[model samples]
Target: MAVVIRTANWHSERSAIRSIRDAVFVREQKVPADLEWDTLEESARHFLVFKDGEAIGTGRLTADGKIGRLALIKSARGLGYGAKLLETICEHAQTLGHQRVYLHAQQQAQGFYSRAGFIVKGDIFSEANIPHIRMVRDLDFSSG
Candidate 1:
């Protein structure tokens, strides 16, 4: 299926982004309500992936260009949406003068991040009852 990935700002896309993250991270993955919902929401630039005009996945890019809270509903996994979202965020970060993009990736999703050019820089740790690792991808847009 064809999907459209777009950068989402505050006000217009918050609800859709929240609902998608709530379903994937909070409901399915059992992430604590506190971690699933945080102050970052208001300060971050969100990305929403739509299929047929439906919000199926969402992620965020922080003001400092850190990427986090990546969540994609079960129905949309493995379709390259996650990577697309990350690429979009990283590209935006490049435009914003960010040198790197970081994320605390769940252990199970480490490989996914790795495939997207992220390198694990630290040992695994627990967050919201799930094992996570600090990953970073340096964005060098100077050549382009």
Candidate 2:
């Protein structure tokens, strides 16, 4: 199935976006509900991935080029949906004149982000009881 991703607003897409994040981050990963959702949401750029009219993945980009709250349903993963989501966010960052993008990748997902051209930078750190590493990817501006 083909998955389409597009920019979304917090007001209109909040339910679908929060559903995916709540599933993946809060329930599945055991992250505290409070830490999973925050005030920065109102100003961030959100994106959602849909397949067959069902929301399957979601992510967000901040003004300073920080990508966060990325999640995909178990069934939607390993099918290029994550990579597509990352690419879409990176493209959006470039459009906003951002030259680099960064995200705090869970240790288990470091390899996945690496495959998407993100490089691990800092030491492993614990966030919300989960091990994570900082990863950065520079956007190619030659074509811009």
Candidate 3:
């Protein structure tokens, strides 16, 4: 399947973006509703992954270089949407003068992030009751 990923407007696309995240995070992962939805959504840069015009995955990058709330539907897992979303967010961060992009990767997803150039930075911790590890990827802008 050919999937398209683009920067999202949280205001205009909130429902669509929320649907994907809610399904993956809240519904499936059992994340608390209060913790899953936060004020940062208004200020962060979000990305939505679409397959056949349906929102199937989403992620966000905050101004301070933190990438969070990355989620993809079960059918889309292992199909490259996750990596594509991460790459897009990291590239956007690079253009915004950020040297590195970091994220709290879920324990099971650590390998996925590692393959995308992120290295673990700290010991495991719990977020929304799920084990997570801090990972960081330095953007190499020397070529540009």
Output the number of the TM-score-best candidate. Answer: 2
* Model 2 CA deviation exceeding 4 Å by range: 141-144
lDDT of 2 by residue, 1-144 (tens): 667899998998899999999999999999999999898899999999999899999999999899999899998888888899999999999999999999999999998999989999989999999999999999995865
State each model's CA lDDT, in order. Answer: 0.86, 0.93, 0.92
Ranking by TM-score: 2, 3, 1
Tens-digit lDDT track for model 1 on 25-95? Answer: 88888888887888877888888889988988888888876788888888788888888888988998888
What TM-score against the true fold does each predicted structure earn? 0.93, 0.96, 0.95
Candidate 2 clash figure, as a count: 0
lDDT of residue 132 for candidate 3:
98
lDDT tens readout by residue for model 3, 1-144: 668999999889999988988888999999999999998999999999999998999999998999999999998888888888888999899998999889999999999999999999989999999999999999995775
Candidate 3 lDDT score at position 13: 97
Tell me, what's the RMSD of every candidate?
1.5, 1.3, 1.3
